[model samples]
Target: MDALQSSLLHQSALSYAYPLYRNLLDNSIVFLYHGPITPDLVVDILSLVENRLDDTGEDRRISKKLFNIMVESFSLGEDVERGHAVLLVRQLPYLYTVAIGRRIASSAVYQVKAFLDWVNTLSPEALREAYQRQLEKDDPRNLSLVGGVPAISILDLARKSHGILNYNFEYLNDSDTFFSLEARLQKTI
Candidate 1:
Protein backbone atom coordinates (compact mmCIF):
# COMPACT_ATOMS: atom_id res chain seq x y z
CA MET A 1 0.00 0.00 0.00
CA ASP A 2 1.45 3.39 -1.06
CA ALA A 3 1.18 6.55 1.03
CA LEU A 4 -1.69 7.80 -1.10
CA GLN A 5 -3.60 4.51 -0.69
CA SER A 6 -3.00 4.55 3.07
CA SER A 7 -4.25 8.15 3.22
CA LEU A 8 -7.31 7.25 1.24
CA LEU A 9 -8.06 4.34 3.54
CA HIS A 10 -7.68 6.57 6.58
CA GLN A 11 -9.93 9.15 5.00
CA SER A 12 -12.49 6.47 4.22
CA ALA A 13 -12.52 5.35 7.81
CA LEU A 14 -12.84 8.93 8.99
CA SER A 15 -15.67 9.53 6.55
CA TYR A 16 -17.67 6.82 8.31
CA ALA A 17 -16.57 7.70 11.82
CA TYR A 18 -17.01 11.48 11.64
CA PRO A 19 -20.70 11.23 10.92
CA LEU A 20 -21.22 8.83 13.80
CA TYR A 21 -19.27 11.11 16.09
CA ARG A 22 -21.39 14.06 15.05
CA ASN A 23 -24.59 12.11 15.47
CA LEU A 24 -23.69 11.14 19.00
CA LEU A 25 -22.68 14.68 19.83
CA ASP A 26 -25.80 16.16 18.25
CA ASN A 27 -27.98 13.73 20.15
CA SER A 28 -26.36 14.61 23.48
CA ILE A 29 -25.11 11.11 24.11
CA VAL A 30 -22.88 11.15 27.17
CA PHE A 31 -22.01 7.46 27.19
CA LEU A 32 -22.37 4.55 24.78
CA TYR A 33 -21.45 0.85 24.94
CA HIS A 34 -22.15 -1.77 22.32
CA GLY A 35 -21.10 -5.36 23.01
CA PRO A 36 -21.59 -8.05 25.57
CA ILE A 37 -22.69 -6.73 28.94
CA THR A 38 -20.99 -8.25 31.94
CA PRO A 39 -20.88 -7.47 35.62
CA ASP A 40 -17.43 -5.90 35.44
CA LEU A 41 -18.37 -3.78 32.44
CA VAL A 42 -21.53 -2.65 34.21
CA VAL A 43 -19.50 -1.56 37.21
CA ASP A 44 -17.05 0.34 35.03
CA ILE A 45 -19.83 2.00 33.07
CA LEU A 46 -21.60 2.98 36.27
CA SER A 47 -18.41 4.35 37.71
CA LEU A 48 -17.83 6.45 34.62
CA VAL A 49 -21.39 7.73 34.75
CA GLU A 50 -21.11 8.46 38.45
CA ASN A 51 -17.98 10.43 37.86
CA ARG A 52 -19.60 12.37 35.06
CA LEU A 53 -22.62 13.10 37.21
CA ASP A 54 -20.46 14.25 40.08
CA ASP A 55 -18.40 16.40 37.79
CA THR A 56 -21.54 18.05 36.50
CA GLY A 57 -22.78 18.52 40.08
CA GLU A 58 -25.86 16.47 39.46
CA ASP A 59 -28.15 16.05 42.42
CA ARG A 60 -27.32 13.13 44.66
CA ARG A 61 -30.90 11.88 44.67
CA ILE A 62 -31.15 11.94 40.90
CA SER A 63 -27.78 10.32 40.56
CA LYS A 64 -28.84 7.43 42.74
CA LYS A 65 -32.01 6.96 40.72
CA LEU A 66 -30.07 7.02 37.48
CA PHE A 67 -27.62 4.48 38.84
CA ASN A 68 -30.40 2.10 39.73
CA ILE A 69 -31.99 2.49 36.32
CA MET A 70 -28.67 1.78 34.62
CA VAL A 71 -28.15 -1.35 36.65
CA GLU A 72 -31.47 -2.79 35.59
CA SER A 73 -31.02 -1.76 31.99
CA PHE A 74 -27.60 -3.33 31.75
CA SER A 75 -28.78 -6.53 33.35
CA LEU A 76 -31.13 -7.03 30.42
CA GLY A 77 -28.09 -7.70 28.27
CA GLU A 78 -26.79 -10.51 30.41
CA ASP A 79 -29.10 -12.98 28.74
CA VAL A 80 -28.13 -12.24 25.18
CA GLU A 81 -26.23 -15.23 23.82
CA ARG A 82 -26.43 -14.79 20.07
CA GLY A 83 -26.04 -11.03 19.59
CA HIS A 84 -24.49 -7.99 21.16
CA ALA A 85 -26.32 -5.37 23.23
CA VAL A 86 -26.28 -1.59 23.27
CA LEU A 87 -26.48 0.82 26.17
CA LEU A 88 -26.57 4.58 25.80
CA VAL A 89 -27.13 7.46 28.15
CA ARG A 90 -28.25 10.75 26.72
CA GLN A 91 -28.54 14.08 28.45
CA LEU A 92 -31.31 16.30 27.18
CA PRO A 93 -32.48 19.74 28.16
CA TYR A 94 -35.00 18.56 30.75
CA LEU A 95 -34.42 14.87 31.17
CA TYR A 96 -31.83 12.10 31.12
CA THR A 97 -32.49 9.18 28.83
CA VAL A 98 -31.10 5.68 29.50
CA ALA A 99 -31.63 3.26 26.68
CA ILE A 100 -30.68 -0.43 26.33
CA GLY A 101 -30.99 -2.62 23.28
CA ARG A 102 -30.56 -6.37 22.87
CA ARG A 103 -31.57 -9.05 20.48
CA ILE A 104 -34.03 -11.52 21.95
CA ALA A 105 -35.58 -14.72 20.71
CA SER A 106 -38.37 -14.00 18.29
CA SER A 107 -40.72 -16.14 20.34
CA ALA A 108 -40.31 -13.89 23.38
CA VAL A 109 -41.00 -10.66 21.55
CA TYR A 110 -44.74 -10.66 21.95
CA GLN A 111 -44.59 -11.54 25.62
CA VAL A 112 -42.00 -8.89 26.36
CA LYS A 113 -43.92 -6.24 24.46
CA ALA A 114 -47.19 -7.14 26.12
CA PHE A 115 -45.61 -7.05 29.56
CA LEU A 116 -44.07 -3.68 28.92
CA ASP A 117 -47.37 -2.33 27.62
CA TRP A 118 -49.19 -3.53 30.72
CA VAL A 119 -46.57 -2.11 33.03
CA ASN A 120 -46.68 1.22 31.25
CA THR A 121 -50.41 1.51 31.80
CA LEU A 122 -50.25 1.27 35.58
CA SER A 123 -50.45 4.30 37.83
CA PRO A 124 -47.46 5.19 39.99
CA GLU A 125 -49.20 3.85 43.08
CA ALA A 126 -50.05 0.64 41.30
CA LEU A 127 -46.48 0.32 40.13
CA ARG A 128 -45.29 0.65 43.68
CA GLU A 129 -47.68 -2.04 44.78
CA ALA A 130 -46.49 -4.27 41.97
CA TYR A 131 -42.89 -3.66 42.90
CA GLN A 132 -43.52 -4.51 46.51
CA ARG A 133 -45.31 -7.72 45.59
CA GLN A 134 -42.57 -8.74 43.21
CA LEU A 135 -39.88 -7.95 45.72
CA GLU A 136 -41.59 -10.10 48.30
CA LYS A 137 -42.04 -12.95 45.85
CA ASP A 138 -38.52 -12.90 44.46
CA ASP A 139 -35.77 -14.67 46.32
CA PRO A 140 -32.65 -12.56 46.20
CA ARG A 141 -30.40 -15.56 46.41
CA ASN A 142 -31.95 -17.17 43.35
CA LEU A 143 -32.32 -14.12 41.15
CA SER A 144 -29.21 -14.85 39.14
CA LEU A 145 -30.04 -18.45 38.49
CA VAL A 146 -33.65 -17.92 37.55
CA GLY A 147 -33.16 -16.10 34.26
CA GLY A 148 -30.09 -13.86 34.51
CA VAL A 149 -32.47 -11.48 36.33
CA PRO A 150 -36.11 -11.30 37.19
CA ALA A 151 -39.09 -9.21 36.17
CA ILE A 152 -38.92 -7.62 39.61
CA SER A 153 -36.06 -5.51 38.36
CA ILE A 154 -38.29 -4.19 35.62
CA LEU A 155 -40.93 -3.33 38.17
CA ASP A 156 -38.32 -1.57 40.24
CA LEU A 157 -37.24 0.36 37.14
CA ALA A 158 -40.83 1.41 36.43
CA ARG A 159 -41.35 2.47 40.01
CA LYS A 160 -38.21 4.57 40.18
CA SER A 161 -38.59 6.16 36.74
CA HIS A 162 -42.16 7.17 37.60
CA GLY A 163 -43.53 4.66 35.13
CA ILE A 164 -41.97 6.48 32.19
CA LEU A 165 -40.67 3.49 30.28
CA ASN A 166 -40.45 3.45 26.50
CA TYR A 167 -39.62 0.46 24.33
CA ASN A 168 -39.62 -0.75 20.74
CA PHE A 169 -38.90 -3.91 18.78
CA GLU A 170 -37.17 -4.09 15.43
CA TYR A 171 -37.61 -7.16 13.35
CA LEU A 172 -34.26 -8.75 12.77
CA ASN A 173 -35.23 -12.04 11.21
CA ASP A 174 -37.33 -15.12 11.81
CA SER A 175 -35.33 -16.20 14.82
CA ASP A 176 -34.47 -12.95 16.52
CA THR A 177 -35.83 -9.48 17.16
CA PHE A 178 -33.98 -6.47 18.47
CA PHE A 179 -35.64 -4.97 21.52
CA SER A 180 -34.85 -1.56 22.83
CA LEU A 181 -36.01 -0.22 26.18
CA GLU A 182 -35.68 3.36 27.30
CA ALA A 183 -36.48 5.18 30.53
CA ARG A 184 -36.44 8.91 31.01
CA LEU A 185 -35.69 10.69 34.28
CA GLN A 186 -36.83 14.26 34.59
CA LYS A 187 -34.33 16.79 35.80
CA THR A 188 -35.52 18.73 38.79
CA ILE A 189 -34.30 22.21 39.26
Candidate 2:
Protein backbone atom coordinates (compact mmCIF):
# COMPACT_ATOMS: atom_id res chain seq x y z
CA MET A 1 0.00 0.00 0.00
CA ASP A 2 0.96 3.67 -0.15
CA ALA A 3 2.09 5.89 2.74
CA LEU A 4 -1.23 7.74 2.93
CA GLN A 5 -3.17 4.46 3.13
CA SER A 6 -1.02 3.01 5.89
CA SER A 7 -1.45 6.10 8.03
CA LEU A 8 -5.26 5.88 8.26
CA LEU A 9 -5.22 2.27 9.35
CA HIS A 10 -2.61 3.10 11.94
CA GLN A 11 -4.77 5.76 13.55
CA SER A 12 -8.03 3.80 13.46
CA ALA A 13 -6.35 0.67 14.69
CA LEU A 14 -5.65 2.37 18.00
CA SER A 15 -9.37 2.16 18.74
CA TYR A 16 -9.76 -1.31 17.33
CA ALA A 17 -11.06 -2.38 20.72
CA TYR A 18 -14.35 -0.63 19.97
CA PRO A 19 -16.99 -1.71 17.48
CA LEU A 20 -17.83 1.95 17.07
CA TYR A 21 -14.45 2.52 15.54
CA ARG A 22 -14.93 -0.38 13.19
CA ASN A 23 -18.47 0.84 12.65
CA LEU A 24 -16.89 4.11 11.65
CA LEU A 25 -14.77 2.26 9.15
CA ASP A 26 -17.77 0.26 7.97
CA ASN A 27 -19.82 3.39 7.55
CA SER A 28 -17.29 4.93 5.19
CA ILE A 29 -16.78 1.68 3.34
CA VAL A 30 -20.53 1.44 2.88
CA PHE A 31 -20.00 4.57 0.81
CA LEU A 32 -16.48 4.58 -0.65
CA TYR A 33 -17.45 7.01 -3.36
CA HIS A 34 -17.89 9.68 -0.68
CA GLY A 35 -14.38 11.10 -0.66
CA PRO A 36 -11.26 10.68 -2.75
CA ILE A 37 -12.32 7.14 -3.62
CA THR A 38 -14.28 6.46 -6.78
CA PRO A 39 -17.24 4.11 -7.30
CA ASP A 40 -15.27 1.77 -9.57
CA LEU A 41 -12.28 1.84 -7.22
CA VAL A 42 -14.53 1.51 -4.19
CA VAL A 43 -16.13 -1.58 -5.67
CA ASP A 44 -12.73 -2.85 -6.68
CA ILE A 45 -11.42 -2.59 -3.12
CA LEU A 46 -14.72 -3.78 -1.63
CA SER A 47 -14.80 -6.74 -3.94
CA LEU A 48 -11.43 -7.71 -2.54
CA VAL A 49 -12.56 -7.40 1.05
CA GLU A 50 -16.02 -8.92 0.41
CA ASN A 51 -15.04 -11.57 -2.12
CA ARG A 52 -17.82 -10.21 -4.31
CA LEU A 53 -16.72 -9.84 -7.93
CA ASP A 54 -13.00 -9.53 -7.23
CA ASP A 55 -10.32 -11.63 -8.90
CA THR A 56 -7.66 -11.23 -6.22
CA GLY A 57 -8.39 -14.77 -5.00
CA GLU A 58 -6.43 -13.91 -1.91
CA ASP A 59 -6.53 -11.81 1.24
CA ARG A 60 -8.13 -8.34 1.12
CA ARG A 61 -5.39 -6.40 2.89
CA ILE A 62 -5.30 -3.97 -0.05
CA SER A 63 -9.01 -3.29 0.29
CA LYS A 64 -8.70 -2.91 4.03
CA LYS A 65 -5.76 -0.56 3.59
CA LEU A 66 -7.63 1.32 0.91
CA PHE A 67 -10.48 1.75 3.39
CA ASN A 68 -8.12 3.52 5.76
CA ILE A 69 -6.68 5.57 2.90
CA MET A 70 -10.15 6.63 1.83
CA VAL A 71 -11.04 7.78 5.34
CA GLU A 72 -7.80 9.45 6.36
CA SER A 73 -7.29 11.01 2.96
CA PHE A 74 -10.68 12.65 3.13
CA SER A 75 -10.30 13.49 6.80
CA LEU A 76 -7.19 15.47 5.86
CA GLY A 77 -8.95 17.05 2.89
CA GLU A 78 -12.47 17.85 1.71
CA ASP A 79 -15.15 15.23 1.00
CA VAL A 80 -15.82 14.64 -2.69
CA GLU A 81 -16.82 10.98 -2.71
CA ARG A 82 -19.43 10.60 0.08
CA GLY A 83 -22.41 11.06 -2.22
CA HIS A 84 -21.36 8.32 -4.61
CA ALA A 85 -20.42 6.01 -1.77
CA VAL A 86 -23.77 6.51 -0.07
CA LEU A 87 -25.70 5.90 -3.27
CA LEU A 88 -23.98 2.59 -4.00
CA VAL A 89 -24.52 1.05 -0.60
CA ARG A 90 -28.04 2.41 -0.42
CA GLN A 91 -28.83 0.50 -3.61
CA LEU A 92 -27.45 -2.83 -2.37
CA PRO A 93 -29.94 -5.44 -1.16
CA TYR A 94 -28.94 -6.49 2.34
CA LEU A 95 -31.40 -9.41 2.15
CA TYR A 96 -31.19 -10.43 -1.47
CA THR A 97 -30.17 -13.81 -2.96
CA VAL A 98 -26.84 -12.78 -4.42
CA ALA A 99 -23.50 -14.05 -3.05
CA ILE A 100 -22.90 -10.84 -1.07
CA GLY A 101 -26.46 -10.89 0.28
CA ARG A 102 -26.26 -14.38 1.73
CA ARG A 103 -22.95 -13.76 3.45
CA ILE A 104 -23.46 -10.13 4.45
CA ALA A 105 -25.94 -10.93 7.21
CA SER A 106 -23.78 -13.61 8.78
CA SER A 107 -20.64 -11.56 8.33
CA ALA A 108 -22.35 -8.55 9.83
CA VAL A 109 -23.25 -10.65 12.83
CA TYR A 110 -19.66 -11.73 13.28
CA GLN A 111 -18.23 -8.21 12.88
CA VAL A 112 -20.71 -6.84 15.41
CA LYS A 113 -20.00 -9.58 17.92
CA ALA A 114 -16.25 -9.31 17.51
CA PHE A 115 -16.39 -5.54 17.93
CA LEU A 116 -18.49 -5.91 21.09
CA ASP A 117 -16.08 -8.34 22.68
CA TRP A 118 -13.12 -6.18 21.79
CA VAL A 119 -14.67 -3.10 23.38
CA ASN A 120 -15.80 -4.94 26.48
CA THR A 121 -12.20 -5.39 27.55
CA LEU A 122 -11.17 -1.79 26.99
CA SER A 123 -11.24 1.16 29.38
CA PRO A 124 -14.04 3.45 28.24
CA GLU A 125 -11.78 6.46 28.77
CA ALA A 126 -9.24 5.14 26.30
CA LEU A 127 -11.71 5.19 23.35
CA ARG A 128 -14.93 6.36 21.79
CA GLU A 129 -17.04 4.64 19.18
CA ALA A 130 -20.33 5.94 17.72
CA TYR A 131 -22.48 6.48 20.83
CA GLN A 132 -25.50 8.36 19.51
CA ARG A 133 -26.96 10.30 16.59
CA GLN A 134 -25.03 8.53 13.82
CA LEU A 135 -22.42 5.87 13.40
CA GLU A 136 -19.10 6.69 11.72
CA LYS A 137 -18.65 9.97 9.85
CA ASP A 138 -15.47 11.54 11.15
CA ASP A 139 -12.91 9.92 8.84
CA PRO A 140 -13.04 9.53 5.07
CA ARG A 141 -10.90 6.52 4.27
CA ASN A 142 -12.68 4.24 6.73
CA LEU A 143 -15.31 3.33 4.12
CA SER A 144 -18.73 2.28 5.40
CA LEU A 145 -19.77 -1.35 5.24
CA VAL A 146 -23.16 -1.21 3.49
CA GLY A 147 -23.22 -4.95 2.87
CA GLY A 148 -22.51 -6.31 6.31
CA VAL A 149 -24.96 -8.86 7.69
CA PRO A 150 -28.67 -8.52 7.17
CA ALA A 151 -30.38 -5.49 8.66
CA ILE A 152 -32.43 -7.83 10.84
CA SER A 153 -29.35 -9.31 12.47
CA ILE A 154 -27.58 -5.94 12.68
CA LEU A 155 -30.60 -4.33 14.36
CA ASP A 156 -31.16 -7.34 16.58
CA LEU A 157 -27.58 -7.23 17.79
CA ALA A 158 -27.70 -3.47 18.27
CA ARG A 159 -30.89 -3.53 20.31
CA LYS A 160 -29.70 -6.47 22.32
CA SER A 161 -26.52 -4.58 23.08
CA HIS A 162 -28.09 -1.20 23.88
CA GLY A 163 -28.43 -1.63 27.64
CA ILE A 164 -24.81 -2.68 27.79
CA LEU A 165 -23.56 0.08 25.47
CA ASN A 166 -24.31 3.66 24.53
CA TYR A 167 -25.75 2.93 21.03
CA ASN A 168 -29.27 1.67 20.48
CA PHE A 169 -31.28 0.14 17.67
CA GLU A 170 -34.86 1.00 18.62
CA TYR A 171 -35.45 2.19 15.08
CA LEU A 172 -34.26 -1.14 13.74
CA ASN A 173 -37.67 -2.67 13.68
CA ASP A 174 -38.72 0.30 11.54
CA SER A 175 -39.54 -2.48 9.17
CA ASP A 176 -42.73 -4.30 10.10
CA THR A 177 -41.15 -7.68 9.54
CA PHE A 178 -37.94 -7.08 11.43
CA PHE A 179 -37.12 -8.59 14.84
CA SER A 180 -34.06 -8.79 17.09
CA LEU A 181 -32.33 -11.87 18.43
CA GLU A 182 -33.00 -10.26 21.78
CA ALA A 183 -36.75 -10.61 21.36
CA ARG A 184 -36.43 -14.22 22.44
CA LEU A 185 -33.88 -13.33 25.11
CA GLN A 186 -36.08 -10.55 26.42
CA LYS A 187 -38.82 -13.07 27.12
CA THR A 188 -36.50 -15.67 28.61
CA ILE A 189 -34.33 -13.28 30.62
List candidate 1 segments past 4 Å from native.
Answer: 1-12, 139-149
For residues 1-189, could you state the per-residue lDDT of candidate 1 as single tens digits?
999998787666757798899999999998899998889988998999999999999999989988988998887777656668999999998888898887877777777877788889999889989778877777778652212235776777787788568988899898888888898888882
TM-score of each: 0.86, 0.21
How much does candidate 2 score in TM-score?
0.21
Best candidate (score: lDDT):
1
Predicted structure with the largest TM-score when compared to the true one = 1
What range of 10 consecutive residues in model 2 has the weakest lDDT sum?
A: 95-104
lDDT of 1 at 178: 83
